[model samples]
Target: MKLREEDLMDILVGATILGCGGGGSLEEGWKLIKRELKKGRKFRLVDVDDVPNDKIVASPYYVGSLGGNSKDNLAVKSFILLEEFIGEKFFGVVSTEMGGHNTAAALTTAAELGLPLIDADMAGRAVPELHHSVYYIRGYNMCPFSVVTAYEDKIIFSRTRDDLHAEKLVRSIVKVTGANVGVTSHPIRGKIFKRTIIRNAISLAMDIGKSVRKAKEEDKNWVLSLLELGGFLLFKGECVYMERREGSGFTIGEFELQVIEFYLKMRT
Candidate 1:
């Protein structure tokens, strides 16, 4: 599917909701999209099943805590370096996870590389650690991964003891490289990727986004429509208290919602 401006906004809205407050910022995602659009780049998504079995694909994402000041094209740079190191062209780019920024990172990388963005991702939701991916859970190796820091420090791991160790190593690097880096990892053939990925996840987000947009356009109740689409009304309240801190390359935070009422139900 070719994504237009409206489609980008819809995806961002849906992905942000799915991110559960951890997928990077919507403003960052929009900036990436607008930058690519200004360059006349096309954003396209392809189904996993449509990929050839022999084709090679990789997941591109950012790793580190929120809030950073880096002007380098880190994700794209990492992807290019990985392709050079592997001596093989990537057939497509898959997202590491769905979120405002990560999804935009993957999409922009695909656009810059003139490749299709796979509609699937390693994780259906934004996760805090590298080990929290479906690929890791399915025993996929994240070897030969490339990491590019904001300061232009590039490293590639031919092997790692495990995904958890990989996460630790990257976090340690982040401490010196401005607390953020772009990563391209888990280079896998389309066959294994299809089996391990959270299939149609992008489509799911797009559908939710479209529903919400339609609701807004028709002046309908978006919350009700979302519930009808299998969303649960978890809470209707105001955040009475909130605190957040950055540590260990992760955002540690807490919030208390003052509930007006608890209306939890699943629409049939």
Candidate 2:
């Protein structure tokens, strides 16, 4: 898969739109994606059929406190470090946990690597922990997982017999990275991918993004336009409560109205 230099911004915009309010801020995801684009990496989106059945596929993304660090900073380049540790050309596949940011994180990596991203993810919705992926439920091992963080000063490498252990080790590394570290996990074979992945998610995200962009430009009502585009409203409410914490690690939290109405778990 070869990426063109021009499409990265549109892709990032679309990914953030899919985030449904909870994904990482668009400023952060776009800043990292754009920097990679400037570095001359053009990514391609890959279909599940394109990967070999026996080869390993991994998902890399950001994990951190989404509160205090909400502002955009173009200096963040954690994905490169994670990719460096893997020490191979990667095909950015979305993590099983779905959010605006993770979905975009997959494409941004794909664009930067000039590789075709897999259309599927392990989980179809946002999840709080690493072990929550559908891949683990199917008994897949998490070998070849790498955790990279700026403060860690070194890439953490692991070949785990179980995904849970991989999660445990990576979470420890997240602390070193200051609550928001980039992680890549879930190596899978191409053959198993046919059965396990939510196919064409990248393209779907792009299409959704295009529609939203059109709607915004045409001055159409956002909610109505989204509905017209076949996206269901998952939630709609004013923020009534919010909080923050610094426990074992940095923590940020918020609550808003019309709960779960906008949470559309895209089908593979």
Best by lDDT: 1
lDDT of each: 0.85, 0.59
Give a tens-digit lDDT track for model 2, residues 138-253: 77765555554555444545566576766666666666556566666665667776787777655655666667677788998755666765666555666667665644333555
lDDT of each residue in 1-268, candidate 1, tens digit only: 8988888888887887788887788788879889999999999989999989998999888888767432467999999999999999999999888788888889899998899999887889888888888988888878889999977889999998988999899988887665679999989998888888899888888888888999999999887778766888777889999998887777789999899988766455
The alpha-carbon RMSD values of the candidates against the true structure, listed in the order shown, are: 1.4, 5.0
Give the Å shift of residue 175 in candidate 2. Answer: 2.5
Evaluate model 1: give its lDDT: 0.85
- Per-model TM-score, in order, reads 0.95, 0.75
How far residue 92's Cα lies from its native spot in candidate 2, in Å, is: 5.6
